[model samples]
Target: MTDRTPPAPSLAQLRALIAVADAGGFGEAAAEYGVSQSSLSEAVAKLEALAGRPLLRRTPGGTVPTEAGARVLTHARAAVQAAADALLAAQEENGGLSGTLRVASMRSAATHLLPPALAAFRARHPRVTVALLDSDAGGGGAPAVRSGRADLAVILADEAPDLRLSPLPPDEYLFVAPAARGTHPVTLAELGAAPLILPPHLDSCYRRIRTYLAARGVSLTAVSEVEQDSVILSMVGHGLGVTVMPRLALLPLPPGLVALPLPEPLARPLALAALPHRAGLPVIRAFTQAVLSHLPVPELPAKEPGPLPVPVSAPPLN
Candidate 1:
């Protein structure tokens, strides 16, 4: 009698699984990989057959990995990344850099921080393609890098302790309220006077602000929790309430509003995150240098010794 053994999964199948999971649906994944949905689905089906278990589940929200699927995905991502690195290494040996460098970043950073750096990197390594994935959720960038969906992630500093981080200048948080309220360094009392409108509790910036205020014996609750920075600003503009947000998110502050320093200054530190093992890759190194070279050092507001009662001129908005 001859023994029959199951076929080993191919790298193509592994990549298909990763793509579906990351993209969150068969149609989207197919579009991204430039393959038909049937082909992508077949690849994942084959992978599941080899493992003898269901890997993905369909839901109203989107396709998501099942528990077993999630476990397999971690290995799939590692395997796919390793294969890419091997290919990249071979290409680098020829003294040329050619491949995609995926970067995950929050929307604000993507808008304000990455353009110059990306332009500089493209100029230096025209052969290498750069993909920017917008991750709007707080600290969403770190998870994308950890899952091997991105080579680098622009995120809050110290957001992921296990990942290697390259720190960038911090973005100061400012108190924003109606211009009718008058422009003055906000007192702790005034901060609590208005019904607070703030980012969702899951937001890293919100957590930082909450913690900082908690330490100072200030406990305030948000009357409305919003995720979009622009919406929050608009809400404040309409006198819904006041908010504290990172300076980068409040740029070009809407007309009829003012931003002032908090009674005690606070800031959100930013960083580029990468898996420790891949931190030394030539492409990663090149892009890191580009970011450092092109990103201007932010001019943070000077720290006040204490809250001032007199109104101060609001900083110029550009």
Candidate 2:
């Protein structure tokens, strides 16, 4: 004879046996499961046979599990709960919202969007640790998400289509010049005529500024092209040339530079993208909510965002 054991008892049979013990008899268990008492009894019998032990003793003190039955019931309840937890985990995974969330964002988010939200999320969930891959330019975000490097990304508007796109609050772009340039606002046309330190074409703000100027039939002298906002602003502070940037990006302006709104209002759109399953996790939700609450839509002077690190060659123009 083979010395192999019988296949383990099926979960369904274990469940039926537990129900009978709980409900006092097969008749009651059958009523609960909408099956016949005979069927329920057969199910329990199958469970006992697989376990190679008698599970219940009916000695007129109402039906009760024998010692063996009690042990099986203990494991059955645990197994059921474990199975339920696994199912919930699978659902969360399918919805793209739960599990460890990794993020990569362009400079604006790295500097402005993530700090507060990340702090808040940490306070709430000390167990969840976030990996912030600092990417000042938008190019890093797409590969991070697509290659499973990051769960989500807050990239430039131009990079939105490369992954998934979600439009953020509208924000205006302004020209920043040395404070010595004075407080008078300049027309978009005139501003375009000034020597400009611009971001590379891969940057969304760069493309937006270029498009806005082209549409207005204005062309400025392009002096320098930089990859990051801080560097571009630093170049401006150094008397390199004036540059255009979203209002939120101006918070940490150098001492000598003053921000001037363009005569014609222009808005730069920001967006968030993620792999299909990355958006739904609890951490992502909490992080996104915290960011949205902290990053105001209006450029209110009193609600100005915190200072960010900008490469400053000298104090801003004053």
Best by TM-score: 1
Model 2: per-residue lDDT, tens digit, 2-104? 7787587777886787788878987777888798888778888888888888998786766799999988887886665445435434543223333455678
Please identify model 2 stretches exceeding 4 Å from their true place.
1-99, 162-166, 301-318
**lDDT to native, each model:** 0.81, 0.68
TM per prediction: 0.83, 0.58
Model 2: lDDT equals 0.68
Model 1, which residues run further than 4 Å from truth? 1-7, 20-32, 36-42, 57-64, 91-94, 137-139, 219-222, 300-318
In model 1, what lDDT does residue 65 have?
96
Scored against the true structure, residue 266 in model 1 reaches a CA lDDT of 93
Q: What TM-score does candidate 1 get on C-alpha atoms?
A: 0.83
User: Tens digit of lDDT per residue, candidate 1, span 185-252?
Assistant: 67887776678888888777778887887888875754578988889999998999999988778766
